[model samples]
Target: MAETVTPAVGDTPAPASTRRERTGWYVYDWANSAFQTTVITVFLGPFLTTVAELAAGCELGADSCAGYVYPLGIKVAAGSYYPYLISLSVFLTVFVLPVIGAVADRTTHKKRLLGAAAFTGAGATIAMAFVTGDRYLLGGALFLVANISFGAAIVVYNSFLPQLGGPDERDGISSRGWALGYLGGGLLLALNLAAITMLSEDDNPQRTLDLARWSIVSAGVWWAAFTLVPLRWLREHPTAAALAGGGGNVLTDGFRQLGRTLREIKAYPLTLFFLLAFLVYNDGIQTVITLASQYGTKELRLEQGNLIITILLVQFLAFGGALSLGALARRIGAWKTVLLSLVLWTAVIVAAFRLPAEAPLPFMALGAAIGLVLGGSQALSRSLFSQLIPTGKEGEYYGFYEISDKGTSWLGPLAFGLVFQLTNSYRVGLVSLLIFFVVGFLLLLAVPIRRAVVAAGNTPPRVL
Candidate 1:
């Protein structure tokens, strides 16, 4: 397993899109990341949680104020409401993105779908400005629309990878996309923090809440405005199926195509196994990210200032880290680079489990390390997946890929919660994440990547 999977390298190169078009692709990442960083990461959950708590008739910081809020007449702990919304959004995307992907592959309308989904999400996100006191239902419904549209847009976005660059170029391009995304997200977040700080005065509680609401609006505007860059640059390259002229209704045919692909997919075991490994490990990665602030605050009692700085550090460092890892992948193959990253991921978990209270410096160092590996592993995974998708089926496969790629899968957090409940130790629960990396590593190690490329009717890249 230690030996690299290097196949014969005499095949003709894959046709890559022009450099300008590739830049357009990168800008889309830059655009959407505003939503990820601003709404999803910084403001929405906390704001909405506070709202839910109000609905439950409890002050947020009150001791012994464990209470429930009902959304759509269903009982939910106020604290758990955000997680439920996230789980619901992710679950819906499992059905939505795949069908969207299947449709994109069969039509000449990929670019339209991308713009439509992006704008639809941005519109819904903009409407989040209206989600104030006792509007938890409005917030939840808007998020479901925003998040599912986000994933649908991403499926179409990811399918462009194979066409945007040759296998040799994908690692670099994907890295740049993630790097730019981090930069974009970080910049907007900094401005947002500044606006929130300047406008929020002591004793003006209403003003403070208003600032948060407006920041949500700014993120939506940013997302919608930046999306034009990609839509302007990307010309649709119709799929073979598109040119073949089936004349069938796209929605109906898309699902039919989806059903067919499911039945036919088993023959590509290498790709299936890779996806399984991805689902497991990526879930761990996302769960760790989602829970870190809670762990730092509840377990370590770190100040809010410390957490903010640590998060911003990861954002900037991940930009450079993604590019560096892509360069490394060029030299030592993407597959092995990812395996190395998993080892680093495991080390981060070990350090986290042993972290002591009130140690901001150590915690910041951990953030730096997580930053170094986060974008690299994720960007490479997307590029590597491009190699294993059967030609003419890129959209559908990447749809499946999106389910595992983003903020969707919630099972890892579910497991993490269960472990914490059983042991009553955050450290023990954190360490339990090791199982995902370990299983993913073993599964990835067993994959014959070069053989998988050939099996997918692809010419193996020079490195892998």
Candidate 2:
């Protein structure tokens, strides 16, 4: 509810005020990724499935657990627990996050809002430790809160991009943040993997489950602790006084601004086209990240320790990949670099279908392939989009960007779940992602970055 200080037009600085503040902004990426890497990408899916099975009074080895009634008396199959929950959370968030983003744009203490959302999400994550056997409802409710907060916080975080740098610096800056994110997430994942391996007893599922629960709790702690740096250092830029025609009510002004912005967005056709392309491919990428460990656990019958290690490998390798792709973008351009990454993503999906169940070597190779492209594709996409946003509207525009990112996310997971339910095959479910990648690649090829920049009344990148 904080209002921004108004500054005269054309008075904003070229970049962040100091190296310290810039580092603080980057550290936020390091802070929040613990939840993304550990909870969303690796552990939570398998853990929630176990909880669902227990709730249904079924043993771990069963093909299907019947009579697992979710909250509100809805019956859910055990196999669909994680995917359906993710889909449900995304569906709910897509409706409200844009409004949250608009409000953040009007606030002077944007960093405070970001910190509040981060800690609130982290609290939900820490509470996951209490979700014991037959407590699936508790786990699902907590996950919904965490995911919603995560999405809202990201809207505020991304709005800081224009303040950090101009178009030329965006790729390196964005990629550096992503690399730091990998470092932070990877470091904690390694520690948790070591602890879980040491604590897990042979032939004891309960002990392994307990260790996994503690790992989730630790990620929450890491998120809250590291976020303090950004909260203390990142200064808020002045906002327009007549934001949405200068109404007294901030929320009313925010919605009015959002509507005007949506109407104006049509003038920049390439921006809309690029967003469509991003919407498609990002769906595939998000689906792969969220479902990878679940596939390893359920389809490949891999041990929990190995799946954790595989993703640990992914995190570090993705660190290098993010930096490497950023450097590559300097030579070729961010758009070209991202398009190339999409090619690799397409290959990764096709190869996924051919991977034999229980083969460590092939699985590890797939993990390596995924690690190589994962960070690069996402980092470049963000940088490229930052180049197209109009001046002084970062928060409102980023809300639309996030909507494209998370709103379409439900389609990929829903498709994966439905395919698995119908065919009883994870491979078939995975194949559905290929459609997203291929279509996205084709759409991206048509975007004119220079034209898009000019259309948005922004400077075009030198390379483009």
Candidate 3:
């Protein structure tokens, strides 16, 4: 199992070689990440909770808020709105992205599908501007739609990876995309933060909420505008003509192909092992990104402005961090660097439990640490996984990859929400994420990377 996977050398039709095509693909990352940073990481979670608290008529910061009933007869603490909404979103996407992936593989409208997903998501994000007081249900609905779209778009976006570069070129190229994402996300967040500061009145929660709504609109605009780059330029291999021959039923053929791919995956035990490990650790990562602001605000009593600044700091740091870690991967091997990053993740969670409430600087320091590893770890994992994908089945295989990515996203938030509900302590919930990293770390160790590569008909990178 420890032996590296090294398939015999075989020629693959090289991906598009033009610089414009490559740059167009990278720009899509720059586009969608605005939603990831401004909406998911920085603003929407805390803002929605505030809205839910108002909707439920719960007195601010009261234990009785736990008794407040949401739209679906769902009783959750005022603090529970964002995490619960995200949990629901991730649960749905677990099923959706794989199907989207399968279809993208069978169709030639990959760019069109990508555009539809992005615009639909942007529309949802823009609608968040209408989510005012007592509009928790509306906000939740939009979040669900936007999140599902986000997950679906990412499926198609990631599937393009194997078409963009060969196995040897994937690590650097993937890192560049993530770094671009950080830069784009960070830039929008900075402007949004500044806008929120200028427009939001310190004493007026409602006014602050209004400004936050506009910020959401701005992020959507940024996402839609930048998305046009990839939509116009990133070409897909011709598959549309073959669609007529496949029983003229894209859905049935997609399902059939997906079934075959699922069965095929059983023969690649190491790939399965890696997916399981990724499912666990990436959940921890996603949960932290999703909930960190909420925990900082609701539990630690940090100011929104300080938290926004911290998020901005993370975005900038992560840009460099992705590049740095990619270079580090070249030196130490991606597996070892990824494991090291997981250790740091575990440490961050541990540090989170002990972080003193109302200490913005300390929280920001912890955020900086998270920033340093977050992009690096995720980027490397994507590239490493790319090396193990069976040729010509990139879309279907990456579909399973995304399923692994988003499927487990449900567990972390649900656990965080449930733990917070039971004990009314965010610290306890934060500590619970440690199990993911630890378990993932152990599972990662058991993976025979070299064997996985060879079994999937890939050559293991020399560094690995």
Candidate 4:
């Protein structure tokens, strides 16, 4: 396996031509976020749960199916299946993302890997139209493939950030990407929501199913169509002749390098500390993203229309929030800004726990608060870690970063699920998230950013 390397951070001037090329790279986020918004976050979760119940041959209202009682002894419906499917998807991504990221870096074919993943995801999304009663397994399978591709493509996309921006420019560029993503995602989701409302009737199950399928296909088509912008604009880095001299395979090298990096972490204490902080806090972030809708539906008893509207508000607010945060970071520094966001997150989670079931306004207020911090925290964290990576191993180190982002995500969700399962209350689950925020905030405070960047630059190279 090839070892992960960071690009040099000196004031090496990027060519004017290269700067021109970077514009198109931002468009990829615009293109791909449609899938994230429509398929993963808003539309699909509810649709899948609805479909799963239909597949299980359970009536709209039933006490049990397949001998399993509903946790709350409420009606056993298709909605019950969605959480399990999402859990399975999360589990698969944890194991697959690191390997996929490593392979893309070692091969110096990040673009190709990204393209392949995108196409696979798109195909699976399109195939969702075939899902029907007794086809829950098929729907689950497609979701698995689509989500894995989404995660893998993200690794490749993030790797391009270093090529586009230096330490001075990275925060702005990262913020721009995230903001653009929110705009693109929100626009498409709004269109899909409109289509569903206009084309489907309340009592027409087949028509509703068709509308759902079209929404899924729209995400795939949107992703594939928009990807061309980045495909045409970005350039891959030149591989070193000496490093390429042997019959060394990039895939084999990637794994070897990953192992070596794991062992070398003790020498980079600050980097280690940042990674731990990221792991903990990001777990909370991922849990919120995954479970927010479920919480609205199950605990708050929100109507579908209200839930969709709240999500749409989140998308637009996230755009403004991310850009404003970039400006704020410039004034006070990224680390402090992130700590403040974590504090806000803790407060919001506590508020969510206290929100009454009938209070839709407070729930929307909660969504607005989430929008303000979500984009800034994630975008700045990516840029911050980009500064810490050693030159030449961007892919390898990011592989580990992806592991932190995706791998440890299970902790938050698992804890949330367990708490909900035991207490039959999401309030307990929401309160437990405070622990992750507090721990991650303390760990992040311990990292010395200046020393870590210098040490990462000075570290000696090694063959994986």
lDDT of 2 by residue, 1-464 (tens): 33222321232335535667778889998998999998888888888888888887788545445535466677777667778888898888766677767777776668888988899999999999899988998999999998888888888898887787766777888999999999999999999998987778887788878888899999999999999999987888746643434447766867877778777878878888998899888988999998888888888878887788789889999999999999999999999999999999999988878888777678888888888888888888988998788776777777767764532277788899888877877888999989999999999999988899778877777785
Clashing pairs in 2: none
Error of 4 at 269 (Å): 3.0
Q: Provide the lowest-lDDT 10-residue window in model 4.
A: 60-69
Q: What number of clashing residue pairs does each candidate have, in the order they appear?
A: 0, 0, 4, 16
lDDT of 3 by residue, 1-464 (tens): 12222322346534544667778889998999999898888788878888888877766444235545456776678677778887888778767877787777777667888899999999999989889868888998999998889888888888888777766677878899999999999999999888888877756766777877888888899999999999887777744433453556766777777778787778888888898899899989999998887898888988889999999999999999999999999888888989999999999999989999899999999989999999999999998998887765666667667754532287799899999888988999998899999999999988988778888887677676
Better of 2 and 4 by lDDT: 2
RMSD of each: 4.5, 4.0, 4.4, 5.7
Locate the minimum summed-lDDT window of 10 residues in model 2.
2-11
Tens-digit lDDT track for model 4 on 1-464?
A: 22222343454433122544566667877887888777766667656655665665655323223322242344333443555555666677766776766666666566787788878888888888888655766777888888777777777777777667556667778888889988998999898878877776776656765676788889999998888777777677633521473657766776776677668767777777788899888888877777777678667877656776788899999999999998888777788789899999889888888899967898898899999998898888888888777666666666657654532266776777667656667678778888999998999888877777778863211100
> Which residue pairs overlap in candidate 3's backbone?
4-450, 4-451, 5-450, 5-451
Clashes of 2: 0
TM-score of 4: 0.87
lDDT of each: 0.81, 0.83, 0.82, 0.72
Flag regions of model 1 displaced more than 4 Å: 1-9, 61-65, 202-209, 294-305, 356-359, 417-432
TM-score of 1: 0.92
Candidate 1: global Cα-lDDT?
Answer: 0.81
Candidate 3 residue spans exceeding 4 A from truth: 1-14, 59-64, 238-247, 404-408
Error of 1 at 419 (Å): 5.2
